[model samples]
Target: MTKTDLRHRDVAEAAASQPMLQQVERWSAINSGSANLAGLATMAGLLADAFSALPGELALLDGAPSERVSASGQVLETLHGRHLRLRVRPDASRRMLFTGHMDTVYPADHSFQSISPIMDGRLNGPGVADMKGGLAVLLAALSAIERSGAAGSIGYDVLINSDEEVGSPSSAALLADLAPTKIAALTYEPALPDGTLAGARGGSGNFSILVRGRSAHAGRNPADGRNAVVAAADLTLRLAGVASPGLSVNPAKIDGGGPNNVVPDTAVLRVNFRPAGEEDVRHARTAVEAAAASVARDHDVAVEVHGGFGRPPKPVDPAAEKLFALVRECGRMIDLDVRWRSTGGVCDGNNIAACGVPVVDTMGVRGGAIHSPDEYLIVESLAERAMLSALAICRIADGGLA
Candidate 1:
């Protein structure tokens, strides 16, 4: 074997030897759902402790102020748990950013709280595949790179946020602030069950539209009363009607209703949009505003629109293609074939890509059935993916991307 191949094999073996499965089992036991502040805190503490093995200045930063529209149509501030940030070799000329999410879709009271071995080396549990396993892979890879003494020249910052499954409403600013400083980025979101990565992801936006109408007695003055619920329903239909091949609109929920004796005065319509490109995003915003105006005018109700596109579309530009090629080359070095395809799913990678940084987002374990009770992690992928990421990161530190 060539010298380079031998070196890669050494790093891969080192990465494969990490205690990733133990870490995944231990971490997945905690429920760090996006909305569960207490659970997130516990998870964050454990992550901080685990990541302390690497050389870095670690700290827990407070989450940014986030707002949400209540079912009563009142806008209120929502609290999120702290985010973990670690900076290593900050003064190095070459810098990279690594990001992951500690939060999962499972809530504190979720039923799927235990981990068990399933068929074909799969481990079924909450957050095991969605990201706790990814975190373990990240830590193992970085630790392996450090052991190989290849990270001295290239610095990197690690950001693990508590709110990603919920659109990263609280941690978006942190991502924006740190993305531009990095030459490249790697996000530890799980790959497909077959180990295929996500590429050129579509953009996503969530909005909550509040409708207000005059309430009146249903029996005596029904004709004079404006029904907010009816107006909200009309808005949902109009929003969904604007969906096309490139843009998908999902009107997830509508909150507002009262006793039959009285006309409902307030309602909130929650909708989500996925746009394939910048033009699609513009079209979607315009469609929403126009539909809201039409609904208000037709229903004689006041309409208020809240929320904007949090994740911008990530296209496979030249820079991104270069990054993907580098990852593919690294995969080949370790006798692994790495490929990617465009997906409708959105993640912190979308936000990082918006800042002009080329990021390979799915540098995590191979798993399937994410965001559901059937979530499972391919146990062997812990070392396999760690080796992949470690080799890629070391190559970048060696000026592969430059």
Candidate 2:
């Protein structure tokens, strides 16, 4: 074998030797749901301790302040857990960003809290595929890179945030700040079960519209009352009609209404929008505002809109294509076939791409049925993906991607 091949084999072997499965088990055991502040704290602490094995300056930083509109039509500050940040070789000319999330879609009271082995080397558990396994792979790969002495020429910053499943409201700003400084970025969101990566992701926006009107007794003065719930319902239908081939709108829920004896004065409609591109995003926003205005005028209710798009659309630009090509080449060296296709799903990669950074986001384990009780991680992929990532990082450090 050539010297380069030998070097890659050594790094892969090193990555395979780490206790990645054990780490996945330990991390998945904790319920670090996005809204579970206490659980996220515990998970963050454990991650900080595990990631400390690498050479870096690590700290647990508070999440950015977040706000949300309540069901009662009042805006309230939302609390989020701390995020773990690690910076290694900050002065190096070639810098990269590695990102993952500690939060899972499952809450503390979720039934899928325990892990169990399934058939064919698969393990089922909460966040096992959608990212606890990914985190393990990331640690193993970086550790292998360090051992191979390949990280010296290229520095990397690691950010494992507490909020990602909930649209990254608290960590979006942090990601934006770090993304511009990196030449490339890798995010540990799981690959498909067949190991296909996600490319050219769509953007996501969440909105809460509050409707207010005058209340009166239903039986005696119903005609004198302007029903806010009815207005909110009208708004929901209008928003849904805004969907097209490029933009999808989901009016998820409406929160309001009281006893039938009186007209409800307040209601809040929660909706989500998925835009295929920047033009779609602009069209969706305009549609929302225009629909709200129409609903208000027709119902004689005051309408207020809150929230904006957190993840921008990620297109396959030339820089991103270069990064993907580099990863595919590394996968070939390891005897693995790496492929990617466009997906409607959005992640922090979308935010990073908005900052003009080339990022291959699905640098994680192969898995399927994410964000559900059936979520499973292919046990073998722990080492396989780790090797792929380590080789890619080593190549980037060697100036392969530029």
Using all chains and alpha carbons, the TM-scores for the candidates as numbered come to 0.97, 0.98
- Residues 110-193 of candidate 2: C-alpha lDDT, one tens digit per residue: 898999966789999999998999999999999988977977899999999999999899988899889897999999999999
Number of clashing pairs, model 1? 0
Sliding window of 10 residues with minimal summed lDDT for model 1: 1-10
Error of 1 at 91 (Å): 1.4
Q: Relative to the unseen true structure, what is the Cα RMSD of model 2?
A: 1.1
Where does candidate 2 have its weakest 10-residue lDDT segment? 1-10
lDDT of 1: 0.93
Q: What lDDT tens digits, residue by residue, belong to model 1 across residues 1-402? A: 778667767887899899999999999999898889999999999999999988989999999878899999999999999999999998988899999999999888889888876677999999998899999999998988898886778999999999999999989999999899799999999999888999999999999999999899999999888999999999999999999999999999999988999999999999999999999999999999899999999999999999999999999899999999999998898778999999999999999999999999999999999989989999989989999998888888878898
lDDT of all predictions: 0.93, 0.93
Number of clashes recorded per candidate = 0, 0
